[model samples]
Target: MIKVMDRLLLFVYSLAVGAASVFAIVMAAGGFDADWLKNAVDDIIGEDALVQTLVIAIGVVLLLLSLRIFIVSFKRSGGQAPSINQRTEHGDIRISVDTVENLALKAASRTRGVKDLKARVRAADSGLQIMIRAFVDGDTPIPALSEEMQKTVSELVQETTGIPVSEVSVYIANVTQAPTTYKSRVE
Candidate 1:
C-alpha cells in the first residue's frame, strides 16, 4: 500500500514539475502571452476559495515530496560484501561466508562415500552452524561417513578461518546409483 502511494506521488510530482517547466520555457520564449497567463492564474486563485486551498495543499505536497526525495537520495547500500568481521591486535580481518561454505564443501567431498554435497553456513550465537546435505555412494557406513564429514568440515573451517564452529549437521539425502556398461560379444 505504501509503495503504491509513493510511486503515485512521484508520478504526479514529476508531471506537475515537467508541465510547469514547459510552461515557463514557452512564456520566456514569447510563445505564450506571459501577462495573460499570469492574470488567468491570479483570477483562478483570487476568485475561488477552493482553488486557493487546493493550490496551497499542492504546494505543501510538492514541498514534502521534494524533501522525501532529497532525504532518500543520501541513503546507500555501501556496496560491501557479506563477511564475518574479526578484530585483533594487528588489525581487522573479514572472511566471507561464501569462502566458509566452499571450505565445508571441500572438506565434505574428501569423505569417501559422500557425493552431490551441498553446504550451508549460518551465523550462530556462539559461532557458526554448518549444514551439509549429500548423496551417499553406499561404499561406507552412513554413520561413519556422517561423523567424518562433520568432523572434517568443523575442523577445517575452524582451523583455516580461526572461527569456532558451534555445530555441523549432515543429512544423507539419497544413495547414488551407478550406471552399468555391458558389451555383448559380436554376433
Candidate 2:
C-alpha cells in the first residue's frame, strides 16, 4: 500500500515537473529578447535542452541524497550498516519489508552458537522494526550468548540490508544435542 502511494506520488511529481519544464522552455524561447531572462540565464540555462539537462541532474542528485539518508537512518547505532527503508527512494528502486526480514534471518543463522534463527519485520512510522528469535545451545552462557548473537546478527543484517534492527529477542529454545557415547552407539 505504501509502495503504491509512493509510486503514485512520484508519478504525479514527475508529471508536474515535466509540465513545468515545458512551460519554462516555451517561455524562455519566446522571451529570449527580454533583458531579465537573458541576465538571469546564459546559453547553458537559456537553451531548452540545457534546462532539461539541469533538471535531470538535480533530480538525480536529490534522489541519491534521499537514498543516503534513508540508509543512514535505518541502521542501528554503533556504526552498523544502514537499513533499507520501505519508502526509501534509491535511484527509483524501493526495498520491501520482506527482503529486510529475510536478510536478518540469514545473517542470524550465520552466527556462531546460533542453531536456528527466525526474524520478523514490520513497517514502522519512521522506518522499519525487527524481532529476532535465535535457538542456541544450552551450554552457551546466557550473557555472552545474547551479546555475541546480538552483535553478529545485528551487524550482518544491518550491513547487508541497511535496515536498523529495532528490537532483537533472543530465545534459547534448547541446548545442542549431546554427542553419542561409544556404548550408546554400540547399543
List TM-scores for all candidates, in order.
0.66, 0.44
Residue 31's lDDT within candidate 2 is 48
Candidate 1: segments with Cα more than 4 A from true spot: 1-76
lDDT of each structure? 0.89, 0.66
lDDT of 1 by residue, 1-187 (tens): 7558767778888998999899888888999677898887996679788888888898898899988766656766366867888889999999988999999999999999787999889887799899999999898999999999999999999999999999999999999987788998998
- Off-target runs (Cα >4 Å) in candidate 2 are 1-90, 184-187
